[model samples]
Target: MKWDYLLFYRWLALNMVGFAILWVFHMNGMVEPVFLADSSYIVYVIAGLFLYGMVLCGFRVWKTSRELNWVKRGDKGKLKEFADKSRQSDRESVKEAFEIKLFARISFVKYISSSLVMLGLLGTVIGFIMVLTNIPANAVGDAAQVGKLVGALTNGMGVALYTTLVGAITNLWLNANYNMLRTGVVNLIAAILESADPQ
Candidate 1:
């Protein structure tokens, strides 16, 4: 029933660092810069990174759980006994795992989602600014110039709306998947331990 304490800690550390970085980006005003930019591609890149980080967290959790000592032992009788105890221990550990709790805590999602929403709003604002500044000067100024400026604003608005949509969808997706996967892993470990216990 021995546990690999190091694996648990390492898993936790990685998750914490990832979430921390995500939070930092949000607090630092990612939305402002992305919105005011001349283009929307940078916003896409940032959003992609954020999504990747969430997926990475999930993989780390699953991999760490798989590497536990109890799970690796092959002797049925002994493995069961050990796995049962290890399951109990891991259950306790996972219960207290802050990294898991972070998924539940709205702070992480809120910060990330809010940043995304803000980024969208910023895009919208910039788009509005462009529209206002590019009025035709000639009987129609350069129709092309005004049209181009207006077009930029429309693009910005699209970016803003899409970013916010993505942020919201991702927050829900990440939280739901993480909970389901984590719960399933813990429950399976518990079952293995129970079945392995000597009757």
Candidate 2:
């Protein structure tokens, strides 16, 4: 029934800071922006966002673990209550307690983790289109033009492979981190809820 007044603002601030750090890395050429497609840093930025979301997810897991540990030890001095204690204690309060945990609040990372893979697939499609639309017609003459056409085709292939690789690898890492955090948090919540009825 209650909420952290600055929860959204806190998440937004952390995300903005992460994005700024990524931009600095890109501007300084510490992190390559284009990968293999001279088009732009669109794919790379999406991957960075995925990375940031993973970090946020990890933080949520750590914070929730601490809170749950405190609760298990019968210490709730500063822990935020998800259910109103003044109300009669019941299973409902346990549900409310789970709702207020950091893991529950930051579950959006699950979506972000999946979206990174989709963005990578999108890049692959774009690269294939570039290759198809730029294909040069064969000519009995002008062997030089044929060589240039081959070069263009090769570059297109680079875009497709690079984007797919970035996406797939990043997705694997994000998914692993996200799932681990989800499972740990879920188990901890169940344990904490079962330990005592919040009153």
**TM-score per candidate, chains pooled:** 0.42, 0.68
Residue 92's lDDT in candidate 1: 50
* Clash-forming residue pairs, model 1: 120-160, 138-141
Q: What lDDT tens digits, residue by residue, belong to model 1 across residues 23-88?
A: 797799864654455365535754674576465645645553553444455434333544555566
Compared with the true structure, all predictions reach lDDT values of: 0.53, 0.63
Cα lDDT tens digits for candidate 2, 4-29: 22333344454577568767978998
Residue 62: error of model 2 in Å? Answer: 2.1
Error of 2 at 129 (Å): 1.0
Candidate 2 has a TM-score of 0.68
